[model samples]
Every structure is written in structure tokens, then in C-alpha cells.
Target: MIKECCNKIDNNKVLLSMAIKKKRYEALVQVYHSELYRFAYWLCHDPTIAEDLVQETFLRAWRSLESLQDDKAAKPWLLTILRRENARRFERKQFDYADVENNTLEDNKSVTLDDEMEQTVIHRQINKLSPEYREPLLLQVVMGCSGEEIADILELNKNTVMTRLYRARNQLKEALTDNHEPIKGALN
Candidate 1:
């Protein structure tokens, strides 16, 4: 009788632990899903692939949630997972590079035609940036990550991240200037 009682108590404890984990996972998803999706979209330039990458990233995060010691570290942690998941895509299979012009720009929010055209031009200029500068800039501008967080996600020193961000802004400015577009605080 005592052994059976102990077994029941142990089972209840395990169930309670799982419930806590589930709540934590759900909160994490709710808080970071949109940010993760936007970052992934910019990285791949494809909505479907971006959604896949975010799903895979969250799956990996759920599997390894126990290892994540700090709640404050969640953004950087999830971003790192997403970056790795994106890398794994190449390992799984090579995808034919699609021309940027072929892919339509999608935005849910309503904006004027001029606003949309400006966004398209800015996106094109950003795409022209080399990966090194582009990655840091996107993490900062798109993901709103700090220098430390960007460095942690990219596995680089903070100085390197800052340098890349500066260079990225300069390149983007130059590109827009060449196109005779006024710099309308896009980098800001």
C-alpha cells in the first residue's frame, strides 16, 4: 500500500513539472514569435521558408528549454537557434537562387503607394550589402538587438558587431544616394 502511494505521488510530481514546462514554452512563443518570423524572413527573403525556420527554431528551443538558464537571455538564445536552423537548410539541400524581383513584397499593414515603393528600394539596398554587414544590421534594425546581443548571436566581439553596423549604414547610405533617393532616416 505504501509503495503504491509513493508511486502516485511521483507521478503527480512529474505531471506538475511538465505543466510548468508547457506554460513556459507557450509564453516564450507568444513573446518572440513575430520578431523571430521577421528576422527569419529577412534572412531568407521568403515567407514560407521564414515560417519554416521559425517553427524549427521553436521546436529546437522546446527540446532544449532546460538548458536555457536565464529568461532574460531568451531573445538571443532563440535568435541563435534560428540562425543555426537557417544554416542547416543548406546542408539539407541546395535551393536554386530566386531573383529578388520575382518575389513580391508582402506587408499586412496598409501604407501609401509611395511608402511601399520607398520600402522596396530600402530593402533592395539592404540586400546589396554583403552578408557580414547585412547580418549585424538586420539583427539591430530588424530584431532590435543590442550590440552585446548581436555579438552573442553572431559569436563575434561587440566591437566587430559595431564596426559591421557602421559599415552597413554607410554602404546603405551610399547605395540610396547613388539612386538619388533622399536618406529619410531609414537607417535610424
Candidate 2:
């Protein structure tokens, strides 16, 4: 399968040499948009911003669709675009620190009682992470992108991505364990 997809890339240029850019673009969007939006949502913690970011990423992808190599790498290739667009957004306005770090989880305690309690627990915990850690976590666990792909997307060394992913999950585990601290209640 890997060999077949690589064969499609007549040359090692994702943006330029693909046989049908339009068809590829459509396939890319259809295949990865949901994953991208989820990733962006986790990054921005806002669905509206996530939607806008995904749109911007796709538009940029269309404009420079030729730079991508290895159709298999499309997911992370698109992610690199989204992350850059996210960084550029800060130059437009001075966002408050609070905008990014959502520290008010304590205020939404009842949210843990929902039907999809496990999902809510996980998202709530994920939301609690700083973006530095969250981005790697989302890329690996959510988007299912590989270490090489994430390293490319974040422009970090692959080892750095691996370490960060480890720390991210470790932090998540600690946070979730800390959250389960109703010792007296449980003891009763």
C-alpha cells in the first residue's frame, strides 16, 4: 500500500507533481478535514476558530499543493500548514493569556456527570494542557500521525516530538489521577 501511494507521486513534490491536483485536494479534504478540525479545535479550544483555521489551511494547501511529497504524509503536511496559520493569528491582535490557558475547569464540575463521561473526562483533561504539550498529543493520539509526520508538522526534531508526546501523556495521567481525589467521599 505504501509503495502504491508513493508511486503516485511521479516526483517527490506533493504540491507540484501530483497527476490531479483538484481530485487530490478534494480527496484530502474529505479524508482529513474532520481530523484537522478536531486538532485545530484542541489547539484553539474554539470551534469557530477551528473552522476558520481549517478553511485557511485548506486554502493555503490549495495554493501550494505541490510542495507536499508522499501522499501518505498528507495528514501531517496539512497539519504543518494549520499550525503556521495559528501562529500568524497572534500577530493580528494581542490575545489575553487567559484566552489560551483555560484554567476554569473547576467551575464546570458538573460536566463530569454527563452520559459520555469518559469522553468528557478526556477532553476536559486535554483542554487543561498547555498548547506546547497539547499539539503533540493531538497529532499522535487524535490525528494518528506518525513521529516523523509530527516532527515535520511542528518543525521540531523527531526526538523532541517523541519526548514531548511522552511528557504530554504523563502529564495527562497525573492530572487525571489528581482529579480523582475524592478520598474522603470514596472512603465513605
TM-score of candidate 1 against the unseen true structure: 0.92
For model 2, how does the per-residue alpha-carbon lDDT over 1-188 read when each residue is reduced to its tens digit?
Answer: 99877877745565564558888899999999988887787677677778999999999999988887789878878988998988988878666756563322223345444434555567777777888788888889778888888888889999999999888888888776688643221212
Model 1, 73-128: lDDT tens per residue?
99999999999999999899887766544343577888787777788788888988
Extract clashing residue pairs from model 2. Answer: 14-68, 15-65, 15-66, 15-67, 15-68, 16-66
Cα lDDT of all candidates, in order?
Answer: 0.91, 0.78
Best model per lDDT:
1
Positional deviation of residue 107's Cα in model 2 after best superposition, in angstroms: 23
Residue 164 C-alpha lDDT in model 2: 91
Output the number of the TM-score-best candidate.
Answer: 1
Deviation in angstroms for 49 in model 2?
A: 1.4
TM-score of 2: 0.71
